[model samples]
Target: MHTPLSDQLRILLGPVDLADIDPGATPGAVSHEQTEDELPKLAARLDDLQRRLFAAAQGGHSTRRVLLVLQGMDTSGKGGTVRHVVGQLNPNGIRLTAFKAPTEQEREHDFLWRIRRALPEPGEIGIFDRSHYEDVLIARVRKLVPPMVVGRRYQLINRFEQQLTAEGTVLVKCFLHISRDEQMRRLLARLDDPTKRWKYNPGDVDERALWPEYQEAYRRALEKCSTDEAPWYVVPADHKWYRNYAITRLLIEALERIDPQYPPGDYDVEVERERVLASG
Candidate 1:
């Protein structure tokens, strides 16, 4: 069941303005300190759910999988979410992909071709740090594709996601919403911290300059692609602890809803037990 807090952060299939969400706001009664304190328990629950799902798949009793798509501006904490929120899961059951600019061969095919290839198998959880939304997001913001083409890709994305759901994949798409000032602070911190300096990309500054355009691009993509099969949730991300807590709760709700169960053994349990005992 979704908690009231998860319900609060979800973006319904309709219009939404990035301005309406307060990046610094923590939902309900939860504070940053409270979220941090609660995180380990929530993460443990997530791990158990993932183990169940993976076990069911291993037993050939489950065909369902989860795909979590995270989209946000530079330094909006997608990496942090992956590390803190999802890092607890068994790596064998998780497929994490961080997308960058398409390679020459990827560009030669439809945008979703590469994305389709990376989807999780049955009972696995797939996480995309950035996803197919880039076809409409960066592609539109930077004029990498024509406006009409970008518009068409939106419909294609919707249809593709519909197909995914129909084929037994559950999709959770989150946009890590952070303020421009917050983004700047994070970027500056990256530059100042020697250990984090490797994460600093020169292109991030150029992309930051076009913040307004990217915001508009995201707004349009959210409106067009948010659907029954795969809804987009805009998570307040300026407070990293709150962000991780909110997402962890959301995923727990989703997994509980899925309710994956272990399969009964095909052979006779009594007979198997007797044979094993005799052998020992």
Candidate 2:
């Protein structure tokens, strides 16, 4: 029997050292071509599930929703994952937010306020490009917040997530794990290819210098926040295709378990069919 991809890729509650995992290794599957072949079928399944979820909401049958939190380094394919993976589902069924550095107005509110505002509506899929976790990941690594404050934020995050879960949000948290060497290579590729050159940022190189600090920060966040209600999965992301495939599989599994069925119409199907036929 085949193991579920989530079990193979999920970060079990424990200490997480990014250096220990191979970013290029494909988890639970064999080849890139094999994954490529499987993507369309997976995408079709997602399309049907998303539509059913939306239909259930429109019929006032369910309040359940999904929030996909994507956390990764600069070149870890977070945006690419959105474009290639979550992009498979219907746009109407998805609420996407690419959280950049907070603005002055955003800085005035609690960190989670902006996060809450961007949450998915009932039965929709919310995709966070970089999420509230940055409060711990980047904030801790750069000393943007006091150590005590950072410590407190972890507990607060746990509570905030639990609150979300209690309110019918199913969280799918993902950490796109990539090696330092792979990051450097991708950043350089951005500079080399004219099409990709627009994405090149000198600041990313500076951040790369603090790789060890970032790694430690990520480890700390993963350990502190991988709660049972909403645990994080570490996607080995040097292989972009596998990252997309694995995440797609994870989502399908979650939605299938939810098993949202299309709600029945209020009026008889025969009546609607006769009315349509008569109108034509």
Number of clashes found in candidate 2: 0
| lDDT (Cα atoms) of all candidates against the true structure | 0.87, 0.89
Candidate RMSDs in Å, in order, are 1.5, 1.5
The clash count of every prediction, one per candidate, is 0, 0
1-280 per-residue lDDT for model 2 (tens digits): 3478877777788777777888998888788898788777888989998988888888866988899999999999998999998878899889999999999999999989999999998899999999999999899999999999999999999999999899878888999999888998999899889999989888898998999899898999988999988888988999888899889988987787678888989889999999999996
Q: Candidate 2: minimum summed lDDT over ten consecutive residues — where?
A: 1-10
Candidate 1 residue spans exceeding 4 A from truth: 1-4
Model 1 lDDT, residue 236, Cα: 86
Candidate 1 per-residue lDDT, tens place, 5-33, comes to 65787778767798988998878545667
Error of 2 at 264 (Å): 0.6
Native-referenced Cα lDDT, model 2: 0.89
